[model samples]
Target: MARVELYVSADVEADGPIPGPYSMLSFGLAVCGTFDGTRFTAPDPSERTFYAELKPISGDFDPQALEVSGLDRERLLREGRDPAEAMRAAAAWVKTVADGALPVLVAYPLAYDWMWLYWYWVRFTSRSPFGHSRHLDIKTFYAARAGAMAARSTKRQMPAALLSARPHTHNALDDAVEQAELFQNLFRWGG
Candidate 1:
């Protein structure tokens, strides 16, 4: 028998363009809901969530990227959680929340966040909770569902009804929760 697909919205704040040379300053995950093939059940996104800030793996960083997250690299070097411990904890959290269901990562655009998280997971934990390919790009989801060009399916272009009320605070956890609501709205949309 097929199990439910638990959608987890992910958001990452980084200090540079990519991982390794830079660092994923922080990241967050929020449980959006579940889909048992036919029905989508929306959940309270704030209830099941994970957040972590990690020490920089490399000293190199982009000033503009740092500006976006507003996380101090110097402070993080001193106070951030160890990457291995954090990623392992995050993986465990995903498993616990997923229970018997399959966890499918849901992210806006998908590529950027996935790149950082997947790299960190493999680097630090040897694997990822969402596996290698079970993920969804909300932008593409909207583009297909709305019958619009892929490039034209940006959040600014989405129906106002589909947008979440929460502000995009750039904090990974806040953005993750906000993204969860947007995912719920997009999943239940008919067209």
Candidate 2:
């Protein structure tokens, strides 16, 4: 029997460009759908999801980055969830969503979100739910499918049908769900 693949869309909000120097303020994951050898199945993207806000690991943060995230560092320092605990819960949630299927992380561009998630997972728990390389980039997927230049394949350039109706709110969870919709559309597209 062919192994089933679960696509989990992810988004991250961070205080700085890199992980260790700043911090990942929050992140979210939404199970977009699944694919077996012969077919793709899209369930409600909001049905199985995970989100967390974490305390900063360092005292340092870029003002601009923090402003973009809109996460109060002082508040997080006082009330955010412990990073280790949050990461563990996220891992378990991913496994539960997978339910024996192989879980594959999905993101718009994949690089930034994957970097933060993989780093945090390994740092906090010493393991990652999606493993090191089981992932997909929706942007690249769309580029390849549409036969468009990767750099030129931003959402604005895509056909309206392929875009999600939800606005990019920059709240990790909301963006993740929106991204899940984009993934489902991209995955099922024939062109």
Cα displacement (angstroms), candidate 1, residue 29, comes to 0.3
Structural similarity to truth (TM-score) of each candidate: 0.99, 0.98
Give Cα-based local distance difference scores for all models: 0.95, 0.93
lDDT by residue for model 2 (63-138), tens: 9987777889999999999999999999999999899999999998899999999999999999999999999999
Q: In model 2, which regions exceed 4 Å deviation?
A: none
In model 1, pairs of residues that clash are none
Task: Indicate the residue-level lDDT of 171 in model 1.
Answer: 99
lDDT of 1 by residue, 1-191 (tens): 78999999999999998889999999999999999998899989999999999999998999999899999999999999999999999999999999989999999979999999999999999999999999999888999899999989999999999999999999999999999999999888999
Model 1 regions more than 4 Å off: none
Top-scoring candidate (TM-score):
1
Question: After TM-score superposition, what is the CA distance of residue 126 in candidate 1 from its true location, in Å?
Answer: 0.6
Per-residue lDDT, model 2, residue 62, is: 90
